[model samples]
Target: MRKISVQNLKGGTGKSTTVVNLGAALALKGKRVLLIDTDSQAHVGMHLGIKHSVTLFDLMTIDLSIEEAIINARENLDCIVSDKKVAVLETMLVQMPRREEILRLRARRLKNLKYDYVLVDCSPSISLMHQNALLFADYLLIPVSMDVLSLAGASSIMDSSRMLLQMYEMPLQIMGVLPTIYDGRLNMSKEVVSILETNYKKLTSVLTPIRTDVKLKEAAAAHQTIFEYDPKSRGAEDYMRLADELLELETRLDRQKQKPAEATLTA
Candidate 1:
């Protein structure tokens, strides 16, 4: 399965919103998907309308098998919810041998679990769990609000990732920088876009930015994705567009990989 991580150093930048909507959109397109909420807040699960005591903690520390914790959130969409009790994983980790290596093992298991995509919603902080998520991720997408402070936080996240690469190899590449909660009427939002495009053109993607819609927050509160809540809404439409861009990027990567292999054979 291809792994994607939705991450940002600072909170409230639409990280969970991006994760749920993208996963829902992919599932709507008939792809088998697994969404993992690594945030201790368990907000992804709440958005999916799943209430459970067991969560990633069960998958990692408890006797719960992967299948046991996996919830069928929608047709072709499955989720491993985060628990408020997930803080226990950190406490539990101290007793385990090779604590940092546990996530590597889980990721290997997930690769064989018959999924087209595995989308991880990482915690806001750069903890051990976040490190493991980044290591397993094939691509990382950061959701940035159109503000100078948010952009500054994005830079810090990039720096942290580079530092983490020093401790363990990071096989993942940045997918793109996404603009979230964009408002065309707001000069602050417009200025943020300018700064990002000027500073991060290499990582910026071509997908259209998601406009700030009141319906998005409503959808989350209703325990539904934008598509499920209101397919006609701009939020749903934007996520669909983003999903298409991601699929196209994957196709390009596949072609790029094949070119080297073909050249070797021709040589």
Candidate 2:
């Protein structure tokens, strides 16, 4: 399964929104998607209208199996929800051995499952939980809004990822930098996109931006996904395109991985 963590150091950059909508879009295309919410705010559950007694905290602090913590939120989408209780883990993790690897070790069980994608919605804080998300994920998906603060958040994540790579030798790759809430009519929005493309294009892809849409906020307020709220809306269309783009990128990566083995055999 492809494990991706959607994170930004600043709040309101659409991290949870991207995770929920993108996961839903992929699920609508018949992919089995699992979303893990690591944020104390628990926006993922709110967006999906899924309430659960057992959450990520239970899975980590207790002996609860990962499978048991999972809630089937939609036809092809499942979720491991989180709540305010998850905040305590930051302090609790300090005393635990291999704290950074906790999530990764626990996630190994997912290999036995049939999920096609695992998307983690991470907290905006720099804590043990944040480190765990980075260490657990194979790829990092950053969502930057049309603002300087959001861009700074994206840069912070990139720097942190580089540090983790050098320190732990983890093979985490940048999936892409996604521009969320983009308004083409606004010069500010255009400028932000340009800056992102200019700065990050060489390191990773600057994906198709998700246009500004009131329907997205409405969908969240209604406790539904864009696809579920209004399939014909611009938000829905953008997320669908994102799903396709991500799938294509993953396919290309897989083919690239195979080329080295193919060369070895020929040699």
Candidate 3:
């Protein structure tokens, strides 16, 4: 399974929106997807019109198992919601042994389930939740907004990820830096994308920008994905294209992995 943590230390970077829509899009393509909300705001369930009874707080802090915490949000999408109670989990974890591995240890049970992708919607701050998400995920998909503050936050997130990898010796990869809330008509937005690509492309792939569209907000308000809310909207188009791009990248990586095996077989 491809475990991804969708994070941006800056709020309003469209991180949660991307995670929700991307999961929906992948599910539409017949992939079973799971989304975990690590943010105390609990907006993931709100966006999907799901009122979760048992959230991540129960799963991690209480005796509830991960299977019991999961709620089926869509046809092929499952979710583990979070709420304000999650804020207390950070303080509680402070005294726990191997606090950073808490989420990872719980998530290992997911391997027995049939899921193609696991997307984590992390809160826009550094905390115990962020550490757990980073530790659980194999890849970090950062959504960067086209603004100076967002850029700074993205850099800080990257630095933190590097530090975590060095400290824990976990194989965590920066999957890609996605440009969100982009508007090609604005020079500032265009400049931000150019700057991100120039500065970070060597470090990680720079994905296609998510153009600013009011339809995305409309879809969220309706508690539906872009595809379900308005299939013809620009938001739907951008997310679908992103899903395809991600699949293409995975295909390339799979082929690259096979090359060494093929060479060994020939020898």
Candidate 4:
């Protein structure tokens, strides 16, 4: 499965929103998607209008198995929920051996599960769970809102990811940096996006921007994805575009991986 973590160091950058809608979009395309909410707020389940007594907290604490914590939120989409109860894990994790690899070990069990995609929604703060998320993820999908503060936060996230790669030698690829809450009419929005595209090209792919849309907020409040809430809305349009971009990227990577094998066989 393609493992991706949708994350940002700053809250309110639409990180959770992107995770829910993007997972929905991928599932709509006929792919089996698993969303793991690492945030203590447990917003992923809430966003999808799903509630389960067992959650990721239980899985991490060995109180439940992966299959037990999985919540089928929609057709082709499953979720591992989280809540404030996850905060207690930090203390316990510290005392565990190879704590940083706990999530990674749990993730290995998923290889037999046959999911097309596994998307993790991480918390905004720096925590033990955050490190574990980075270690478990094969790719990082960063959402940068159109503001200076958010932009700075995105840079910090990138820097931290780089440090983690150097320290752990995991070589986690940065899938892309998504521009969220964009408004073309606003000068600040335009400036922030311009800076990201022009200056940060080497860091990662700059994805199509998600425009500012009230329907996005309404969708979350109503417990539906943008597509389910308002398919005709700009919010839906943006996420579909994102889904398309991600699919294309995956295809490209697959082809690249195949080329080496093909050459080895031919040679």
Best by lDDT: 2
lDDT of 4 by residue, 1-267 (tens): 899988789888989999999999999999999999999988999999999898877888784457888889999999999998998989989998888778888767788889999999999977789888888887889899998888888877777876766687545467888999999999998999899998666555789999999999999999999999999999999999999999988875566445633311110
Residue-by-residue lDDT tens digits, candidate 3, 31-121: 9999999999888898999977889988887765689989999999999999999989988999888888788988788998989999999
Instruction: Estimate the TM-score of every prediction.
Output: 0.90, 0.94, 0.94, 0.93
**Which candidate's TM-score is highest?**
2
Give one digit per residue, the lDDT tens place, for model 1 in 1-267: 778888888888999999999999999998899998888888899988986665888777765457777888889999989887776677777788767666556656675679999889988887777876777677778889878767876787777776765467543356778889999999988888877787777443534688898889999999989987899999998999999998887876576456643311110
Candidate 1 or 4, higher lDDT? Answer: 4
Distance (Å) between predicted and true CA of 131, model 1?
A: 1.2
lDDT of 3: 0.87
Give the lowest summed-lDDT range of ten residues in model 4.
Answer: 258-267
Off by over 4 Å in 3: 255-267
- Backbone clash pairs for candidate 4 read none
Q: Predictions ranked by TM-score, top down?
A: 2, 3, 4, 1
What are the per-residue Cα lDDT tens digits for candidate 2 across 1-267?
Answer: 999999899889999999999999999999999999999999999999998999998887887678888999999999999999999988888999998888888778898998999999998877888888888887889999999999999988878766775588645477899999999999999999999989988666799999999999999999999998999999999999999999989875676456633311110
| TM-score, structure 3 vs. true | 0.94
